[model samples]
Target: MNLIKVKGKSENSFDYIHEKWIFKEIKESNEQKFKCKSYKSKFKCPAILQKISDEYKGDDSLHNHPHPVIRTRMEPVNKMKVPKTTRKITASKRITIKPTVPEKLKEFKNLVTAYQLIKSTFIAQVEADDGSCASILSTKYCFDLLGKAEEIYLHATYKIQLSDIKISQILIFFVRRNNIGIPCVFVLSDSTIKSLYAKIWENLILRIPSIKENLKRVVTDCYLPLTFAILEALPQTDVKGCWMNYIRMAARQWKSCNLVNMRHEVLKWSFLIPSLPPDQFKNAIMEINETIRDKKETYIEPVTEKFMSFIKRWWEPAATIISFSNSTNDSINISEYFDRHMGSEFGSLTPDIFQFSECIKRICDNSENTWKMMERGAQFELYEKQSFIKINNHISNNLELLSDGKISLEEYFKQAMTSDIHELILKILETRQYKNDVGRLDEFHKN
Candidate 1:
């Protein structure tokens, strides 16, 4: 699919042409051609119409419609948390400065930790031109080992090596789900079909021996060629989905869609079970599944007439928004990108923040900080002053439930160092607060 960037705004039409990902572009004043295509599709981008069709699918979660769900793994962080001082000492009385890490920072840390824990568990990072290169990820240390997702996972430049096979693989690891063989790694990407090499997977597996046996599912976005590659690499692994990337072509031209918001809660939880530990993880898993099942049992909610009109109000800007690649991957790029970029087209991360919270219970960062961000992005007048304060105090009172922001620092460590945590997982203990899957995890941990 092409996003042709045209200058002087001619017909104002958008269309995709051929296998190449062509986009129309126009030059700014005294600028050269704002060329949208790089001769042909680069190794990074996919083929033409396939990408376009997937992107246009109906993403109307609000109406409870069935749309493809987007999924991506965020990094994770460390433990020693700031406990709610048992004594009612004021902020001034506190000698040690307790930094309330923001939700963004917290999420960044979780992603870093997840990557490190997985890296250590998988040891798949490739060595770069520098011999000391620890991984394909441009990082010296996992971020949040210190603090902040950025600090824990240092961003680095990815200089492409022609000699190296560039295959991208999504590894899915799971703990015993009630001793069932439900756990599997769904390989989603490969070199031959989508330009991503399979050797990249080999290099990773060789680096981390533990992942050899435990690998279960390996799936990717609805990108066909990439999907085909996964089929080639590990025929056994269940190809789940990379729903977000594939939606471009799924349900375009529906006028508007509200499917994602309705199942946002479900999508949040179910997707997480694969990445967590046993029963405790299972507990959270079971809870969300139960909720979704219960919700499904009821009458499906349909979009109201008023909702459509409200949506059309903003339709004019929709094209401008999509053209900017605003909906692209962010759940992956927050800390991964250089200082210049924020990873996805949607620079506003409120949806993802809320989605992650609803899914995992708490981000590695404090619930308080996440709320602050929600307030700042109150463009829809969502975070009214009163609403903000209410959420803050509610989170403060139940900080333990807030993932890493427990009222008791000891509880946070107990949760982190408690039995069954792998070394790689613990490194990012601080970044993404490992929710005990609410009580479902407790049920497993208790038994």
Candidate 2:
């Protein structure tokens, strides 16, 4: 009878049971004696081998028992061995506040990363700031308060097409008192496709009694076409560009590969000096450009002068900001910092509604980041009902007159905007028909 050669710890031995009728004692070649006993044999017997990171690597386990049925072993050493379970990383550590996610309900947790919720996105809604007519609670932003409050970002998940009805619902919610009324400049982050997301914008415009033309400003990432779209939709609305955008655009289209050093320098120069004068800012850029052009031995082709010219040529609202803000700097560091912590929705320039909604909630509660996008007159849209438009318009027009179209905290404290914002929010929540994932999660937290 041919004895099978079993691969053991030393590769020089075989544990072969001689041809006994039944229950034969197994013997190995004297030259191939092995020490470790973690291995298993073919007839559902334990083989001698060392256990490794939840895996057994030996000749018998591979040659004798390599079947899916082996995965079903009860003794674990034989029959079948199932792979050990491991914890999966998520965008946020906790998926929901509810005891368990219901079968049919939508969950925002499905849209974001585990690390993202606590670290990247900030969820904000008005906790305070109720002071306006219309019994509306003056607008205040709310979100999670666990992390260090900073440049938290909002990224939408799938496309959240804002129907006019949805817009009216949201607008009615965002502004507390819709009675004082002026066209409000609703802001959104330009990190995603603007037009696709504009479905959210379409809703906001239709919510109010005012014409779309009255919507004054839209700040955005400074995409060329978006500027035209905003102008077309609301001629009075100025399409402001974020400086981060200009830098990103210039680097992509104008900067050559060899200018790695130049690119880094440009990024540094753009944001470090936010308060510089217009002429000084222009000169600073020119210097960077010249440095790139002159460095023949250590660099690639320099960026075109048009890079600087494009920025200098405009006096648009965010021009000054876009001129100095570097999307690659510490400011950008924070944005990216937030991005890194997020498990999903960071790399791409587009986001869905659920992602966007969570981000907006966070931004509203955080003070520094409030309407920071507005500085750029970016292509913006808010999700709300038409009643919201009436309320926001009341705030915007009146606030514009009261404080000259600029937002101020003190103004909000003076009066309530609509009815109680918290109450209205509850009403909106009721209409959501769907529950807020966080709200559901809160239920889980309590349980």
Candidate 3:
């Protein structure tokens, strides 16, 4: 059998491609053996290859499928070279060098390699400067800022897109530096294609082992495409939905169902759904649906249907751990950061290519400065971190009370909306006491 060696899903393993049929190494096999790729399919293919001395043998006894067309897997193609920076070369003057296509590509590739070496990141793709598409540029800094971060945030800025330059969006990856979130990676894409995003993220995860191994969580908006892409690439990392996005989606659905009066309740449920224990989440959703149906409004059916549909799409199959549910205010902070810098500095919501480049440089410099500062032992008081921990602990404690049947779901919902959960807990106890006293007085009067 003629076998061609190809890269496997992992670094140590190898797959054999043979005349439209692929074979994967069988881990359980004692000998050097490979099973047909379709062995796990419903067809139950029984083809196998066993290594005999320096040669291999194939058995296609149960093979039934026709030959498949061979397609190349998406691999990182190094397209640019890191440019040699001299004392005379500065950030402003670096982009002015008009060079041949080959030279420009080489220079960019080298720069990307240098950036990857420093930033603890991997450059997935670098589009050539054909003037037809936007190119992703990388910087030359020396630090593993991303590796040290346990969580990262993903966001996109459309305000920097230049229509004339074919720049549709700029995707940014933010990692923490001394508790201060900073942009660790940037990708300038021609369009917001889901597959493109998935491919980029997949390549990044595959190329950088630290990010793949050590990254614990990622925060992103409730955009299904982006969320799915992140999960597809970083399967091990927890994907936390942005709080603002969660409220916006729930509110939008509420408006569509003509249930604006129930907006506060809907928002409260939106926060509560992902916070519930996984075993209780689906039932809670059902209970909420029944409660809405009990409202007896003319549009009650639509309200329940819309709410259920929203729950099915967004909340179902999502992890229900409260600590992983919301990204407190990272989304808003990043948006404000972009607005203050990109809006004021560029003086336009949409900047041209040159202005956008400068803005990216500014962002990179800010991130590098943050990394350096953190390395120098400069500390940033993370109010968000403190709040996150407090809120998580508070919710966990309340959830324990809920699970123990000590607090009713109604009271839980009400307290969930309160800013100070401890104060709400105290108020709940006071209300119960007052009601008990009133009941005793009424009973005594009746006697």
Best by lDDT: 3
Model 1 residue 220 lDDT? 35
RMSD of each: 28.2, 24.7, 22.2
Off by over 4 Å in 3: 1-134, 142-144, 177-179, 202-209, 255-264, 321-348, 382-406, 419-447
Best by TM-score: 3
Tens-digit lDDT string for candidate 2 (223-342): 443345445555655544323333333433323322334324333343322323333455555565666577645544434444444334443334444432222121121122222223
Give the per-residue lDDT of model 1 (tens digit) for 31-134: 32223333232212111222333342211111111111222222222212433463335555542332232332212323434333323322233332322112
| Per-residue lDDT value at 204 in model 2 | 35
TM-score on alpha carbons, each prediction: 0.22, 0.31, 0.55
By TM-score rank, best first, the candidates go: 3, 2, 1
Error of 1 at 336 (Å): 15
User: Residue 333 CA error for candidate 2 (Å)?
Assistant: 11
Tell me the deviation in Å of residue 246 in model 3: 3.1
Better of 1 and 2 by lDDT: 2
What does candidate 3's lDDT look like per residue over 97-153, in tens digits?
A: 422222222233334433323223324453323322234444545124556568777
Whole-model lDDT values for every prediction: 0.28, 0.31, 0.55
In candidate 3 the C-alpha lDDT for residue 168 amounts to 57
Better of 2 and 3 by TM-score: 3
